[model samples]
Target: MAKVDILNTKGQNVETLELNDNIFSLEPHKDLMYRYLDMQLTNSRAGTASTKTRSEVRGGGRKPWAQKHTGRARAGSIRSPLFRKGGVIFGPKPRDFNKKLNKKMKRLALKSALSLRLSEGNMIILDDISFDTPKTKSMKEVLSALDLTSKKVLMLLPYKEEKYENVKLSAKNISKIKVIIADNPNQGKTNVDGLNLFDLINNEKIILTKDMVKKIEEVLV
Candidate 1:
């Protein structure tokens, strides 16, 4: 088990939390993390880029000129790749870019990413995050108190509901700061299941609420 100090909004250490070794103290699997990241990025691609091939272009039914008769080189369809306004050759076409990993592999990769952050001392445990109103200044004050104003941060909340809506709004406008909810009320998904390797590795620091930590351990254990 590894212990970390839990900080309040004012940057004061309120208590220490014992983390699950299985999730936060294991050796990081660099290769798995890379594969996980690659999978995520690949899956996110729209894959909508397309180009017309010579056969797909219009007005290519008739050859531009007789072959070998004119002074110019042998002529073909106007849509030939060698001619101007011609269709592309071996060009990109719309296709699926999704990549799939087994559930076990995804879990292991997420744990590896979390452990890497913990080992690097880039994980911050927060007692709670609350906002009375959707105000950016309040979020900035908390970040300032934690001395993370300019740091790239990823904050995870346990749930997305009315209670956390203000907190989400407060942090949305801050550059380099991303806020994600572990679970949505309507989805009924386990909180820690929402943790992904990409956000875990992309951010310089991770801020997890106490509830979020427990939720993560419950799932990852």
Candidate 2:
């Protein structure tokens, strides 16, 4: 069994939450993690970059010169690539750069990412992160206590409820803080068959729950 030091609202240790060895203690597949990270980065790329080709450029429909030129090379049109106003040569076109991974591979990648957090002591277990009202200042205090003022912080709760209203409202406005409703981000096995788990990589802090920990553990292969 593995254990993660549990913390309270004050950023004080409550206790070590016992973790299933299957989830938090296993070795991460370096290759899989790397591959998933690479794919995620590629998929995130807009890949909308494009340029018009010479002929694709507007105007220049009329021929600039006839077959017989005045001691100069014959020109087909001014927009020809051969000329300054010509369309681009092999210009880029919009494309999908997304890389797909098998459901199993994606799960493995997410597991690897989680495992990394555990090993690095970046994973935190909390009894529960609740709020009485939507107070940005209170949430800001939580961030400060965790020393996550300006870092990319991901706060996970066990489930979704009205209690999170304040936390959500408080953190949502801040670009650096992201509060994930457990019910949403906890899509444990929705697409377990066809996954892109690479999205779980590089997060600064991970909240640990027995249920989520178990799910992440079950997919490790």
Candidate 3:
């Protein structure tokens, strides 16, 4: 198990938390991380690059000249691929780039990413964070209090609800700060699969609220 200091919004340490070995102390797998990242990036591609084919191009209905005569070996549509301003041949078209990884592999990859972040000492735990109103200044104050003003921070929040609006709106305009909802009691069962590997690996630090700690453990453990 890995023990870490739990801090308050003021950046003061209030308690200690012992993390589950299965979730935070597991060995990091570089290859699995690479595969997961590659899959995620590849799957996000739009693949909407398209081109007009010979049959689809305009001015192709009428033949340029006679089929066989008039000093011409053969004649076809002006939009033929061999002619100038001709339609493309075998060009790219719209498609879906999504790729799938099995359940077990995805779980292992997430664990590997989490373990790597924890080992790098980039993970933090907060007792709780809230705001009465949706104010960006309040959120900035909280980040400043935690000495994360300029750091890329990923705050794992509780599940979606009206109450979280304050914090969500507060952090919206702040650069280098992203808020993601974690599994919560409202959601009876764990939703570990919803965790995004790209966000986890992209951020420089991970900050989990007290509620999120148990929720993640429930799912990941």
User: Which one wins on TM-score?
Assistant: 1
Between the candidate structures 2 and 3, which one is better when assessed by lDDT?
3
What residue runs in model 2 are displaced by over 4 Å at the alpha carbon? 182-201, 209-221
Screening candidate 2 with a backbone cut-off below 3 angstroms (N, C-alpha, C), the clashing residue pairs are 53-87, 54-87, 54-88, 134-166
Each prediction's RMSD over C-alphas, in Å, is 2.4, 4.1, 3.1
C-alpha lDDT of all candidate models, in order = 0.88, 0.67, 0.83
lDDT of 3 by residue, 181-219 (tens): 754454455533257789998999898887887877878
lDDT per residue as tens, model 2, 1-221? 77667777778887776776654666888898888878878988999999888757876578776777478898778887787756888888999998987877766666666777779877776655667888888888877887778777666544455786566777767787666554544455341222224434546766544444554445454
Instruction: Between candidates 1 and 2, name the one with more favorable lDDT.
Output: 1
Using alpha carbons, what is the TM-score of model 2? 0.79
TM-score of predicted structure 1: 0.93
Each model's TM-score, in the order given? Answer: 0.93, 0.79, 0.89
Best-to-worst TM-score order: 1, 3, 2
Off by more than 4 A, model 3: 66-75, 184-193
Cα error, residue 162 of model 3, in Å, equals: 2.7
Cα RMSD of predicted structure 1: 2.4
